[model samples]
Target: MTDPAAAQAPTTVLGASTPRTPPARLGVAVVHDLVEAIVTGEVQPGAVLPPEGVLSQTFGVSRTVIRESVKRVEEKGLLTVAQGRGTSVNEASAWNVLDPVVLSALVEHDDSLGILDELAVVRGVLEGSMANAAAGRRTAERTAALQHALDHMHETIDDFDAYSQADVDFHFTVMEQSGTRLAPTITRILFDRARESSRFVGAPAAEALRLTLEEHQAVLDAIEAGDAAGAQRAMEHHIAEAWARRRLPTARD
Candidate 1:
Protein backbone atom coordinates (compact mmCIF):
# COMPACT_ATOMS: atom_id res chain seq x y z
CA MET A 1 0.00 0.00 0.00
CA THR A 2 1.21 3.51 -0.75
CA ASP A 3 1.74 5.42 2.48
CA PRO A 4 -0.43 8.52 2.88
CA ALA A 5 2.59 10.47 4.08
CA ALA A 6 4.59 9.47 1.00
CA ALA A 7 1.67 10.40 -1.25
CA GLN A 8 1.63 13.86 0.32
CA ALA A 9 5.36 14.37 -0.14
CA PRO A 10 6.60 16.38 -3.10
CA THR A 11 7.24 14.09 -6.06
CA THR A 12 10.45 14.44 -8.05
CA VAL A 13 10.43 13.81 -11.77
CA LEU A 14 12.61 10.97 -13.02
CA GLY A 15 15.56 13.21 -13.79
CA ALA A 16 14.70 16.44 -11.96
CA SER A 17 16.09 17.54 -8.63
CA THR A 18 13.39 20.05 -7.64
CA PRO A 19 10.60 18.57 -5.48
CA ARG A 20 7.26 19.46 -7.00
CA THR A 21 4.08 19.59 -4.92
CA PRO A 22 1.93 16.90 -6.47
CA PRO A 23 -1.59 17.61 -7.59
CA ALA A 24 -4.25 16.93 -4.97
CA ARG A 25 -4.72 13.16 -4.71
CA LEU A 26 -2.72 12.58 -7.88
CA GLY A 27 -2.07 8.92 -7.13
CA VAL A 28 -5.58 8.11 -5.93
CA ALA A 29 -7.13 9.95 -8.88
CA VAL A 30 -5.06 7.97 -11.34
CA VAL A 31 -5.83 4.70 -9.61
CA HIS A 32 -9.60 5.33 -9.54
CA ASP A 33 -9.82 6.30 -13.24
CA LEU A 34 -7.71 3.36 -14.35
CA VAL A 35 -9.64 0.96 -12.11
CA GLU A 36 -13.02 2.08 -13.44
CA ALA A 37 -11.76 1.82 -17.00
CA ILE A 38 -10.51 -1.70 -16.44
CA VAL A 39 -13.41 -3.06 -14.42
CA THR A 40 -15.94 -1.53 -16.81
CA GLY A 41 -14.13 -3.08 -19.78
CA GLU A 42 -13.04 0.18 -21.41
CA VAL A 43 -9.64 -1.41 -20.97
CA GLN A 44 -9.60 -5.18 -21.19
CA PRO A 45 -7.50 -7.68 -19.34
CA GLY A 46 -4.36 -8.93 -21.10
CA ALA A 47 -4.03 -5.53 -22.77
CA VAL A 48 -0.70 -3.84 -22.20
CA LEU A 49 -0.70 -0.39 -20.70
CA PRO A 50 1.02 2.43 -22.53
CA PRO A 51 4.51 3.21 -21.26
CA GLU A 52 4.84 5.37 -18.15
CA GLY A 53 5.90 8.38 -20.23
CA VAL A 54 2.70 8.10 -22.22
CA LEU A 55 0.63 7.60 -19.08
CA SER A 56 2.25 10.69 -17.52
CA GLN A 57 1.43 12.64 -20.64
CA THR A 58 -2.09 11.25 -20.86
CA PHE A 59 -2.92 12.02 -17.23
CA GLY A 60 -0.88 15.27 -17.33
CA VAL A 61 1.07 14.27 -14.24
CA SER A 62 4.73 13.82 -13.45
CA ARG A 63 6.48 10.51 -14.21
CA THR A 64 6.66 9.85 -10.48
CA VAL A 65 2.90 10.25 -10.14
CA ILE A 66 2.28 7.79 -12.94
CA ARG A 67 4.64 5.28 -11.39
CA GLU A 68 3.02 5.56 -7.98
CA SER A 69 -0.44 5.25 -9.49
CA VAL A 70 0.54 2.21 -11.49
CA LYS A 71 2.08 0.75 -8.37
CA ARG A 72 -1.21 1.23 -6.57
CA VAL A 73 -3.09 -0.62 -9.31
CA GLU A 74 -0.55 -3.42 -9.33
CA GLU A 75 -0.83 -3.80 -5.58
CA LYS A 76 -4.59 -4.17 -5.93
CA GLY A 77 -3.98 -7.11 -8.34
CA LEU A 78 -5.30 -5.22 -11.35
CA LEU A 79 -1.99 -4.80 -13.17
CA THR A 80 1.25 -6.66 -13.52
CA VAL A 81 4.56 -4.85 -14.16
CA ALA A 82 7.50 -6.49 -15.88
CA GLN A 83 10.95 -5.05 -16.37
CA GLY A 84 11.04 -5.65 -20.13
CA ARG A 85 7.33 -5.98 -21.06
CA GLY A 86 5.87 -2.94 -19.24
CA THR A 87 2.55 -3.20 -17.35
CA SER A 88 -0.36 -5.44 -18.31
CA VAL A 89 -3.88 -5.45 -16.95
CA ASN A 90 -5.00 -8.68 -15.30
CA GLU A 91 -8.25 -10.54 -15.62
CA ALA A 92 -10.98 -9.78 -13.05
CA SER A 93 -10.60 -13.34 -11.81
CA ALA A 94 -7.02 -12.55 -10.82
CA TRP A 95 -7.84 -9.27 -9.10
CA ASN A 96 -8.39 -8.99 -5.37
CA VAL A 97 -12.15 -8.66 -5.59
CA LEU A 98 -12.56 -8.69 -1.80
CA ASP A 99 -10.30 -5.72 -1.23
CA PRO A 100 -12.35 -2.67 -0.28
CA VAL A 101 -10.77 -0.58 -3.04
CA VAL A 102 -11.60 -3.12 -5.71
CA LEU A 103 -15.09 -3.65 -4.33
CA SER A 104 -15.75 0.11 -4.07
CA ALA A 105 -14.49 0.69 -7.60
CA LEU A 106 -16.80 -1.99 -8.92
CA VAL A 107 -19.68 -0.56 -6.91
CA GLU A 108 -19.02 2.94 -8.25
CA HIS A 109 -19.00 1.74 -11.82
CA ASP A 110 -22.16 2.27 -13.84
CA ASP A 111 -23.55 -1.16 -12.91
CA SER A 112 -21.16 -2.70 -10.38
CA LEU A 113 -19.89 -4.92 -13.21
CA GLY A 114 -22.38 -7.55 -11.94
CA ILE A 115 -20.47 -7.95 -8.70
CA LEU A 116 -23.69 -7.55 -6.71
CA ASP A 117 -24.68 -11.06 -7.71
CA GLU A 118 -21.53 -12.34 -6.04
CA LEU A 119 -22.27 -10.28 -2.96
CA ALA A 120 -25.68 -11.86 -2.75
CA VAL A 121 -24.09 -15.26 -2.40
CA VAL A 122 -21.81 -14.07 0.37
CA ARG A 123 -24.70 -12.48 2.22
CA GLY A 124 -26.98 -15.45 1.85
CA VAL A 125 -24.50 -17.78 3.48
CA LEU A 126 -23.18 -15.52 6.21
CA GLU A 127 -26.37 -13.75 7.22
CA GLY A 128 -28.51 -16.84 7.09
CA SER A 129 -26.14 -18.40 9.58
CA MET A 130 -26.11 -15.26 11.63
CA ALA A 131 -29.86 -15.27 11.84
CA ASN A 132 -29.84 -18.90 12.92
CA ALA A 133 -27.37 -18.08 15.66
CA ALA A 134 -29.35 -15.07 16.71
CA ALA A 135 -32.37 -17.19 17.46
CA GLY A 136 -30.55 -18.79 20.36
CA ARG A 137 -29.48 -15.40 21.70
CA ARG A 138 -32.63 -13.42 21.00
CA THR A 139 -33.96 -11.47 23.96
CA ALA A 140 -36.82 -9.04 24.44
CA GLU A 141 -34.48 -6.06 24.26
CA ARG A 142 -32.81 -7.29 21.08
CA THR A 143 -36.17 -7.99 19.49
CA ALA A 144 -37.41 -4.54 20.44
CA ALA A 145 -34.35 -2.91 18.89
CA LEU A 146 -34.98 -4.72 15.60
CA GLN A 147 -38.66 -3.84 15.68
CA HIS A 148 -37.71 -0.20 16.33
CA ALA A 149 -35.58 -0.16 13.19
CA LEU A 150 -38.40 -1.75 11.25
CA ASP A 151 -40.77 0.86 12.58
CA HIS A 152 -38.41 3.54 11.40
CA MET A 153 -38.48 1.93 7.98
CA HIS A 154 -42.27 2.17 7.89
CA GLU A 155 -42.35 5.79 8.97
CA THR A 156 -39.65 6.83 6.50
CA ILE A 157 -40.90 4.84 3.55
CA ASP A 158 -41.23 8.04 1.54
CA ASP A 159 -37.65 8.98 2.36
CA PHE A 160 -35.23 6.60 0.74
CA ASP A 161 -32.09 7.91 2.47
CA ALA A 162 -33.62 7.61 5.90
CA TYR A 163 -35.09 4.24 5.06
CA SER A 164 -31.73 3.06 3.79
CA GLN A 165 -29.98 4.02 7.02
CA ALA A 166 -32.62 2.22 9.01
CA ASP A 167 -32.29 -0.76 6.74
CA VAL A 168 -28.50 -0.85 7.29
CA ASP A 169 -28.88 -0.47 11.02
CA PHE A 170 -31.48 -3.22 11.02
CA HIS A 171 -29.23 -5.84 9.46
CA PHE A 172 -26.11 -4.73 11.30
CA THR A 173 -28.14 -4.88 14.49
CA VAL A 174 -29.17 -8.41 13.60
CA MET A 175 -25.54 -9.45 13.37
CA GLU A 176 -24.75 -7.80 16.69
CA GLN A 177 -27.74 -9.45 18.30
CA SER A 178 -26.38 -12.75 17.06
CA GLY A 179 -23.67 -12.41 19.74
CA THR A 180 -20.89 -12.98 17.22
CA ARG A 181 -17.66 -11.09 16.96
CA LEU A 182 -16.60 -11.26 13.32
CA ALA A 183 -19.97 -11.36 11.58
CA PRO A 184 -20.96 -7.88 12.68
CA THR A 185 -17.65 -6.37 11.62
CA ILE A 186 -17.72 -8.13 8.26
CA THR A 187 -21.35 -7.30 7.66
CA ARG A 188 -20.90 -3.67 8.65
CA ILE A 189 -18.50 -3.04 5.77
CA LEU A 190 -20.62 -4.81 3.16
CA PHE A 191 -23.86 -3.26 4.40
CA ASP A 192 -22.42 0.26 4.14
CA ARG A 193 -21.10 -0.47 0.66
CA ALA A 194 -24.46 -1.73 -0.53
CA ARG A 195 -26.23 1.20 1.09
CA GLU A 196 -23.99 3.70 -0.68
CA SER A 197 -24.88 2.35 -4.11
CA SER A 198 -28.64 2.11 -3.44
CA ARG A 199 -28.01 -1.58 -3.64
CA PHE A 200 -29.30 -2.26 -0.18
CA VAL A 201 -32.11 -3.94 -2.14
CA GLY A 202 -35.26 -2.16 -1.04
CA ALA A 203 -37.54 0.54 -2.37
CA PRO A 204 -40.36 2.92 -1.40
CA ALA A 205 -43.16 1.43 -3.47
CA ALA A 206 -46.06 0.20 -1.39
CA GLU A 207 -45.54 -3.34 -2.59
CA ALA A 208 -41.77 -3.24 -2.23
CA LEU A 209 -41.72 -1.57 1.16
CA ARG A 210 -44.47 -3.81 2.46
CA LEU A 211 -42.63 -6.86 1.22
CA THR A 212 -39.51 -5.70 3.03
CA LEU A 213 -41.45 -5.25 6.24
CA GLU A 214 -43.10 -8.63 5.86
CA GLU A 215 -39.80 -10.35 5.19
CA HIS A 216 -38.07 -8.70 8.14
CA GLN A 217 -41.08 -9.42 10.30
CA ALA A 218 -40.82 -13.07 9.33
CA VAL A 219 -37.19 -13.18 10.46
CA LEU A 220 -38.11 -11.42 13.66
CA ASP A 221 -40.99 -13.81 14.17
CA ALA A 222 -38.74 -16.82 13.79
CA ILE A 223 -36.23 -15.35 16.21
CA GLU A 224 -38.90 -14.45 18.72
CA ALA A 225 -40.32 -17.95 18.52
CA GLY A 226 -36.85 -19.43 19.09
CA ASP A 227 -36.87 -21.34 15.84
CA ALA A 228 -33.30 -21.36 14.56
CA ALA A 229 -34.08 -23.30 11.43
CA GLY A 230 -37.00 -21.07 10.59
CA ALA A 231 -34.97 -17.95 11.18
CA GLN A 232 -32.24 -19.22 8.89
CA ARG A 233 -34.72 -20.12 6.18
CA ALA A 234 -36.50 -16.80 6.48
CA MET A 235 -33.26 -14.87 6.20
CA GLU A 236 -32.12 -16.93 3.24
CA HIS A 237 -35.38 -16.30 1.46
CA HIS A 238 -35.10 -12.58 2.12
CA ILE A 239 -31.58 -12.45 0.74
CA ALA A 240 -32.53 -14.40 -2.37
CA GLU A 241 -35.56 -12.22 -2.99
CA ALA A 242 -33.53 -9.07 -2.56
CA TRP A 243 -31.03 -10.32 -5.10
CA ALA A 244 -33.78 -11.18 -7.54
CA ARG A 245 -35.35 -7.76 -7.17
CA ARG A 246 -32.10 -6.04 -7.97
CA ARG A 247 -31.48 -8.25 -10.97
CA LEU A 248 -34.51 -6.75 -12.63
CA PRO A 249 -34.55 -3.30 -14.22
CA THR A 250 -36.85 -2.09 -11.47
CA ALA A 251 -36.31 0.87 -9.13
CA ARG A 252 -34.20 -1.20 -6.77
CA ASP A 253 -31.77 -1.79 -9.58
Candidate 2:
Protein backbone atom coordinates (compact mmCIF):
# COMPACT_ATOMS: atom_id res chain seq x y z
CA MET A 1 0.00 0.00 0.00
CA THR A 2 1.11 3.53 -0.63
CA ASP A 3 2.14 5.35 2.53
CA PRO A 4 0.06 8.21 3.92
CA ALA A 5 2.99 10.53 3.41
CA ALA A 6 2.35 10.25 -0.31
CA ALA A 7 -0.94 12.02 0.24
CA GLN A 8 0.84 14.87 1.93
CA ALA A 9 1.87 16.35 -1.39
CA PRO A 10 0.10 19.62 -2.12
CA THR A 11 -3.18 19.56 -4.02
CA THR A 12 -2.38 22.64 -6.06
CA VAL A 13 -0.16 23.05 -9.10
CA LEU A 14 2.19 25.90 -8.48
CA GLY A 15 3.01 28.46 -11.17
CA ALA A 16 1.35 28.40 -14.57
CA SER A 17 2.42 27.85 -18.15
CA THR A 18 1.92 29.69 -21.45
CA PRO A 19 -0.89 32.11 -21.94
CA ARG A 20 -3.35 32.91 -24.71
CA THR A 21 -5.26 36.11 -24.07
CA PRO A 22 -7.12 37.87 -21.31
CA PRO A 23 -10.89 38.00 -21.10
CA ALA A 24 -13.08 40.81 -22.38
CA ARG A 25 -13.69 43.39 -19.72
CA LEU A 26 -13.71 47.16 -19.36
CA GLY A 27 -9.97 47.66 -18.90
CA VAL A 28 -8.92 44.21 -20.00
CA ALA A 29 -8.38 45.14 -23.64
CA VAL A 30 -5.97 47.80 -22.62
CA VAL A 31 -4.24 45.36 -20.31
CA HIS A 32 -3.92 42.90 -23.15
CA ASP A 33 -2.41 45.36 -25.60
CA LEU A 34 0.01 46.87 -23.11
CA VAL A 35 1.14 43.52 -21.79
CA GLU A 36 1.64 42.16 -25.29
CA ALA A 37 3.72 45.18 -26.12
CA ILE A 38 5.87 44.82 -23.03
CA VAL A 39 6.34 41.08 -23.34
CA THR A 40 7.20 41.32 -27.01
CA GLY A 41 9.84 43.86 -26.08
CA GLU A 42 8.21 46.64 -27.99
CA VAL A 43 8.36 48.50 -24.73
CA GLN A 44 11.37 47.84 -22.56
CA PRO A 45 11.30 47.78 -18.82
CA GLY A 46 12.15 51.20 -17.29
CA ALA A 47 10.71 52.97 -20.30
CA VAL A 48 7.76 55.27 -19.80
CA LEU A 49 4.45 54.57 -21.43
CA PRO A 50 3.27 57.01 -24.03
CA PRO A 51 1.41 60.01 -22.68
CA GLU A 52 -2.22 59.34 -21.76
CA GLY A 53 -3.38 61.46 -24.68
CA VAL A 54 -1.16 59.52 -27.05
CA LEU A 55 -2.36 56.18 -25.70
CA SER A 56 -6.01 57.22 -25.84
CA GLN A 57 -5.61 58.33 -29.42
CA THR A 58 -3.55 55.27 -30.30
CA PHE A 59 -6.02 52.75 -28.93
CA GLY A 60 -8.89 54.97 -30.09
CA VAL A 61 -10.34 54.97 -26.59
CA SER A 62 -10.94 57.69 -24.06
CA ARG A 63 -8.24 58.75 -21.64
CA THR A 64 -10.32 57.20 -18.85
CA VAL A 65 -10.15 53.86 -20.68
CA ILE A 66 -6.43 54.13 -21.05
CA ARG A 67 -5.96 55.01 -17.35
CA GLU A 68 -8.09 52.10 -16.20
CA SER A 69 -6.32 49.64 -18.47
CA VAL A 70 -2.93 50.84 -17.28
CA LYS A 71 -4.08 50.47 -13.70
CA ARG A 72 -4.82 46.76 -14.15
CA VAL A 73 -1.34 45.88 -15.35
CA GLU A 74 0.10 48.06 -12.62
CA GLU A 75 -1.78 46.07 -10.05
CA LYS A 76 -0.23 42.89 -11.43
CA GLY A 77 3.22 44.45 -10.90
CA LEU A 78 3.84 44.73 -14.60
CA LEU A 79 3.91 48.49 -14.54
CA THR A 80 4.75 51.25 -12.10
CA VAL A 81 2.94 54.58 -11.90
CA ALA A 82 3.97 57.65 -10.00
CA GLN A 83 3.39 61.36 -9.72
CA GLY A 84 6.53 62.43 -11.59
CA ARG A 85 7.56 59.40 -13.59
CA GLY A 86 4.27 58.68 -15.39
CA THR A 87 4.02 54.91 -15.90
CA SER A 88 6.81 52.56 -16.86
CA VAL A 89 7.17 48.85 -17.36
CA ASN A 90 8.62 47.03 -14.38
CA GLU A 91 11.47 44.59 -14.50
CA ALA A 92 10.53 40.94 -14.93
CA SER A 93 11.42 40.45 -11.27
CA ALA A 94 8.53 42.73 -10.33
CA TRP A 95 5.77 41.00 -12.33
CA ASN A 96 3.27 38.63 -10.76
CA VAL A 97 4.23 35.23 -12.07
CA LEU A 98 0.84 33.59 -11.50
CA ASP A 99 -1.64 36.02 -12.99
CA PRO A 100 -2.95 34.48 -16.17
CA VAL A 101 -2.64 37.77 -18.03
CA VAL A 102 0.95 38.17 -16.95
CA LEU A 103 1.74 34.56 -17.64
CA SER A 104 0.17 34.63 -21.08
CA ALA A 105 1.73 37.95 -21.92
CA LEU A 106 5.15 36.82 -20.81
CA VAL A 107 4.95 33.71 -22.93
CA GLU A 108 2.64 34.28 -25.84
CA HIS A 109 3.95 37.40 -27.50
CA ASP A 110 7.57 36.38 -27.83
CA ASP A 111 9.68 34.20 -30.08
CA SER A 112 12.59 34.10 -27.66
CA LEU A 113 10.65 31.92 -25.19
CA GLY A 114 12.12 33.69 -22.23
CA ILE A 115 10.16 31.81 -19.59
CA LEU A 116 10.45 28.22 -20.84
CA ASP A 117 12.90 27.05 -18.20
CA GLU A 118 10.84 28.47 -15.36
CA LEU A 119 7.72 26.90 -16.80
CA ALA A 120 9.41 23.50 -16.97
CA VAL A 121 10.50 23.63 -13.34
CA VAL A 122 7.03 24.43 -12.04
CA ARG A 123 5.46 21.88 -14.36
CA GLY A 124 7.83 19.24 -13.01
CA VAL A 125 6.91 19.98 -9.40
CA LEU A 126 3.16 19.91 -9.96
CA GLU A 127 3.23 16.79 -12.13
CA GLY A 128 5.47 15.00 -9.63
CA SER A 129 3.00 15.64 -6.85
CA MET A 130 0.13 14.64 -9.09
CA ALA A 131 1.72 11.26 -9.88
CA ASN A 132 2.26 10.63 -6.18
CA ALA A 133 -1.32 11.47 -5.34
CA ALA A 134 -2.64 9.33 -8.16
CA ALA A 135 -0.58 6.34 -7.08
CA GLY A 136 -2.01 6.39 -3.58
CA ARG A 137 -5.53 6.23 -4.96
CA ARG A 138 -5.17 4.27 -8.20
CA THR A 139 -8.23 2.23 -9.07
CA ALA A 140 -8.62 -0.61 -11.53
CA GLU A 141 -10.53 1.59 -13.93
CA ARG A 142 -7.99 4.36 -13.68
CA THR A 143 -5.20 1.91 -14.28
CA ALA A 144 -6.95 0.65 -17.38
CA ALA A 145 -7.51 4.21 -18.57
CA LEU A 146 -3.83 4.91 -18.16
CA GLN A 147 -2.98 1.70 -19.92
CA HIS A 148 -5.21 2.66 -22.78
CA ALA A 149 -3.46 5.97 -23.24
CA LEU A 150 -0.04 4.33 -23.15
CA ASP A 151 -1.12 1.76 -25.70
CA HIS A 152 -2.27 4.54 -27.93
CA MET A 153 1.05 6.26 -27.43
CA HIS A 154 2.98 3.15 -28.47
CA GLU A 155 0.83 2.44 -31.48
CA THR A 156 1.06 6.00 -32.72
CA ILE A 157 4.80 6.31 -32.17
CA ASP A 158 5.65 6.33 -35.86
CA ASP A 159 3.16 9.10 -36.49
CA PHE A 160 4.23 12.28 -34.75
CA ASP A 161 0.89 14.04 -34.92
CA ALA A 162 -1.02 11.10 -33.55
CA TYR A 163 1.58 10.33 -30.94
CA SER A 164 1.83 13.92 -29.77
CA GLN A 165 -1.92 14.21 -29.34
CA ALA A 166 -1.96 10.92 -27.43
CA ASP A 167 0.88 12.11 -25.26
CA VAL A 168 -1.26 15.08 -24.25
CA ASP A 169 -4.16 12.80 -23.39
CA PHE A 170 -1.86 10.60 -21.39
CA HIS A 171 -0.79 13.55 -19.28
CA PHE A 172 -4.35 14.73 -18.84
CA THR A 173 -5.30 11.24 -17.63
CA VAL A 174 -2.54 11.32 -15.04
CA MET A 175 -3.82 14.62 -13.65
CA GLU A 176 -7.43 13.48 -13.80
CA GLN A 177 -6.55 10.37 -11.80
CA SER A 178 -5.03 12.55 -9.15
CA GLY A 179 -8.56 13.58 -8.13
CA THR A 180 -7.83 17.28 -8.16
CA ARG A 181 -10.50 19.68 -9.38
CA LEU A 182 -7.97 22.10 -10.86
CA ALA A 183 -5.84 19.57 -12.65
CA PRO A 184 -7.58 19.59 -16.02
CA THR A 185 -7.53 23.35 -16.42
CA ILE A 186 -3.95 23.68 -15.28
CA THR A 187 -2.76 20.81 -17.42
CA ARG A 188 -4.55 22.09 -20.47
CA ILE A 189 -3.03 25.48 -20.00
CA LEU A 190 0.41 23.94 -19.78
CA PHE A 191 -0.27 21.80 -22.80
CA ASP A 192 -1.42 24.81 -24.77
CA ARG A 193 1.56 26.80 -23.60
CA ALA A 194 3.91 24.04 -24.56
CA ARG A 195 2.41 23.97 -28.04
CA GLU A 196 2.56 27.74 -28.23
CA SER A 197 6.28 27.62 -27.47
CA SER A 198 6.95 24.51 -29.58
CA ARG A 199 7.90 22.46 -26.54
CA PHE A 200 5.08 19.96 -26.83
CA VAL A 201 6.60 17.38 -29.18
CA GLY A 202 6.18 14.11 -30.92
CA ALA A 203 9.82 13.91 -30.15
CA PRO A 204 9.57 14.08 -33.89
CA ALA A 205 12.61 13.80 -36.16
CA ALA A 206 14.53 12.04 -33.36
CA GLU A 207 14.35 9.21 -30.79
CA ALA A 208 12.89 11.53 -28.18
CA LEU A 209 9.40 10.06 -28.40
CA ARG A 210 10.51 6.50 -27.76
CA LEU A 211 12.46 7.52 -24.66
CA THR A 212 9.47 9.41 -23.27
CA LEU A 213 7.28 6.37 -23.80
CA GLU A 214 9.66 4.24 -21.76
CA GLU A 215 9.74 6.82 -18.98
CA HIS A 216 5.96 7.00 -18.96
CA GLN A 217 5.74 3.26 -18.59
CA ALA A 218 7.98 3.47 -15.57
CA VAL A 219 5.53 5.93 -14.04
CA LEU A 220 2.67 3.54 -14.72
CA ASP A 221 4.52 0.59 -13.22
CA ALA A 222 5.17 2.49 -10.04
CA ILE A 223 1.54 3.57 -9.77
CA GLU A 224 0.21 0.06 -10.41
CA ALA A 225 2.48 -1.24 -7.69
CA GLY A 226 1.23 1.52 -5.35
CA ASP A 227 4.64 3.01 -4.88
CA ALA A 228 3.78 6.68 -4.51
CA ALA A 229 7.32 7.95 -4.15
CA GLY A 230 8.41 5.82 -7.04
CA ALA A 231 5.59 7.17 -9.16
CA GLN A 232 6.37 10.76 -8.24
CA ARG A 233 10.07 10.33 -8.87
CA ALA A 234 9.40 8.72 -12.22
CA MET A 235 7.20 11.55 -13.35
CA GLU A 236 9.74 14.14 -12.26
CA HIS A 237 12.54 12.32 -14.00
CA HIS A 238 10.51 12.17 -17.19
CA ILE A 239 9.78 15.86 -17.04
CA ALA A 240 13.43 16.67 -16.42
CA GLU A 241 14.47 14.58 -19.37
CA ALA A 242 11.74 16.06 -21.49
CA TRP A 243 12.93 19.51 -20.55
CA ALA A 244 16.48 18.69 -21.50
CA ARG A 245 15.29 17.62 -24.91
CA ARG A 246 12.89 20.52 -25.43
CA ARG A 247 14.90 23.37 -23.98
CA LEU A 248 18.59 22.51 -24.21
CA PRO A 249 18.52 21.11 -27.76
CA THR A 250 22.27 20.40 -27.85
CA ALA A 251 22.61 18.12 -24.80
CA ARG A 252 20.20 15.22 -24.36
CA ASP A 253 18.19 15.01 -21.14
TM-score of every prediction relative to native: 0.78, 0.74
lDDT per residue for candidate 2 within 1-253, as digits (tens), equals 8678855643211111222233456467767778777766667889888788777666666789788888888988989999887998899889876677777766665444447766677778888889999999999999999999999999999888888889878888999898877755665676575575544342445488878999999999998889999999999999888877766342322
lDDT of each: 0.77, 0.77
What would the TM-score be for candidate 1 when compared with the true structure?
0.78
Question: Top model by TM-score, which number?
Answer: 1
The Cα error of candidate 2 at residue 183, in Å, is 6.1
How big is the positional error of residue 72 in model 2, measured in Å on the Cα after superposition? 3.4
Give the per-residue lDDT digits (tens) of candidate 1, residues 1-253: 9899866765323223343344588887778777877887777899898888767776778899889988988998999999999899898888976667777778777363366676777888889899999999988998898889888888887887787677677787788888888877676666567656765454546676668778888998998888999999999899888667655463444
Off by over 4 Å in 1: 1-23, 110-113, 198-203, 250-253
